[model samples]
Target: MKRTLTTFIATLALIALGAGARPAGAAGVTNAVAAAGTTNIVASSDGKFTPSTIVMHVGETTTLHLTSSGGVHGLVSNRLHIPLTRIQPGKAVNVAVTPSKAGTYVLPCAIFCGLNHANMKLTVIVKQ
Candidate 1:
């Protein structure tokens, strides 16, 4: 029974992974408009950032493709003062951020993920 349960859970996770964004007919946008140098961020229930840290030049734009594998989570940057809160499950939210100064910015999770929420952190480095 335990093995059966594990197999079921693995199947469920696969289903969630398949259900990323809505169909194009539902989202209305036929094509995704991502600007140049925009990093694609993929977040999961592992409390980790796919790229973890990124390097960008001053005034460089990047779009984050925030995705949830199972439950809901959010992206909140304390150093950059940007927050996207209350994200839903099986959803993908996109945001565009540009660095203006040469320094390091800390990015954190806004919504409640789990006990190790504090460790769900990342850094974005900007250079000249």
Candidate 2:
């Protein structure tokens, strides 16, 4: 009886741990975007942008395909002058960016996304 109880408790613990764990999709990603014409970025509920970094070439127009989950989110880059309005949840918004010069810029979430809003920064690197 004692051995059976111990085994049952161990099994329960394992199940509990597994249930609490989140899949890879929940966490932000690196190199998540493929191709140069358009890149897809998914804003997660945890206030993170998938494919945190965006790389492109100067003079090459790149369109950012943005989506949000859980709530509304907005993306904007002051330096790049990429105008992005409100992005509804589960809806996609596109913003075209053409950098004449090569530099690194940060695109931040314009709308409030929660406590971690400050962390929701997208790195944009333009190569010559």
Candidate 3:
């Protein structure tokens, strides 16, 4: 009876250890996308960026979270030197940017999505 109890305790300990051993990226799996501080931008199949204007303060750092609603898209900003981030349907992309001075920056979709792709413009306003 004592041997059985010891074996049961050892099994429980092994189970506990295994439960604590999580693989990389397992924690906060639901938070794989942008965090709370980043600005969210949604790219739609209709060739538009929702909330086309992003406001930020100069000398402040922030991230832009880009996601697609209906189809694949990308975010491009020549002034910010941001490379195109492929935003697949249901996936999110993040871009970190900091404006040194107060000004207006234009961000657009680098990929040809649809008819209104040329009109897909995102404005970034930095203020003092």
Candidate 4:
């Protein structure tokens, strides 16, 4: 009876751990417009930015809704005029950007996340 109980407890522990595990390379764009001019961007602990590429019009302001799925992250850009922003697991950070020039801007993760941190970047394409 004791052996059976121990096995049952072990199984439960394994299941609990698996529940929190996320698959690698499972990131995708979450660019659905939440509002009239808002774009959703999600960051994950796996070191990825969802909707890694976005398109914006020059002279038009767009709001980026940033959130983290598994870990704390940060973002900042001098060209885009975005301030240092913190993205937490359960909190949302909004950044408004208006591009004055037409070009492709790469915004990398401001904070080091993990092994895949170096590849984490968001590409913004601005057009007239």
Instruction: Give Cα-based local distance difference scores for all models.
Output: 0.64, 0.74, 0.73, 0.83
Give the residue spans of candidate 4 off by over 4 A: 1-34
Which ten residues in a row are the worst by lDDT in model 3?
22-31
Report the CA-based lDDT of candidate 1 relative to the real structure.
0.64
Alpha carbon deviation, residue 119, candidate 2 (Å): 1.2
TM-score of 4: 0.74
For model 3, the local distance difference test gives: 0.73
In candidate 1, how many Å is residue 116 off?
2.2
Please report the TM-score between candidate 2 and the true structure: 0.69
Please give each candidate's TM-score. 0.64, 0.69, 0.67, 0.74
Counting only residues 3 or more apart in sequence or on different chains, how many pairs clash (N, Cα, C under 3 Å) in candidate 1?
A: 1
What's the distance in Å from true for residue 99, model 3?
1.3
lDDT (C-alpha) at residue 4 in model 4: 100
Q: What value does the lDDT take at residue 77 in candidate 3?
A: 67
For candidate 2, write residues 5-123 as lDDT tens digits: 99999999999787555333422332454555988777776777777887888888888777775567778766677876676664568888888888888878788978888887788
The order of the candidates by lDDT, greatest first, is: 4, 2, 3, 1
Best by lDDT: 4
lDDT of 4 by residue, 1-128 (tens): 99999999999999977754532212234544456788888998888888789889999999998888878888898998989898887577789999999999999999888888898899999999
Q: How well is each residue in 47-72 modelled by candidate 1, as lDDT tens digits?
A: 76656787777776776666654456
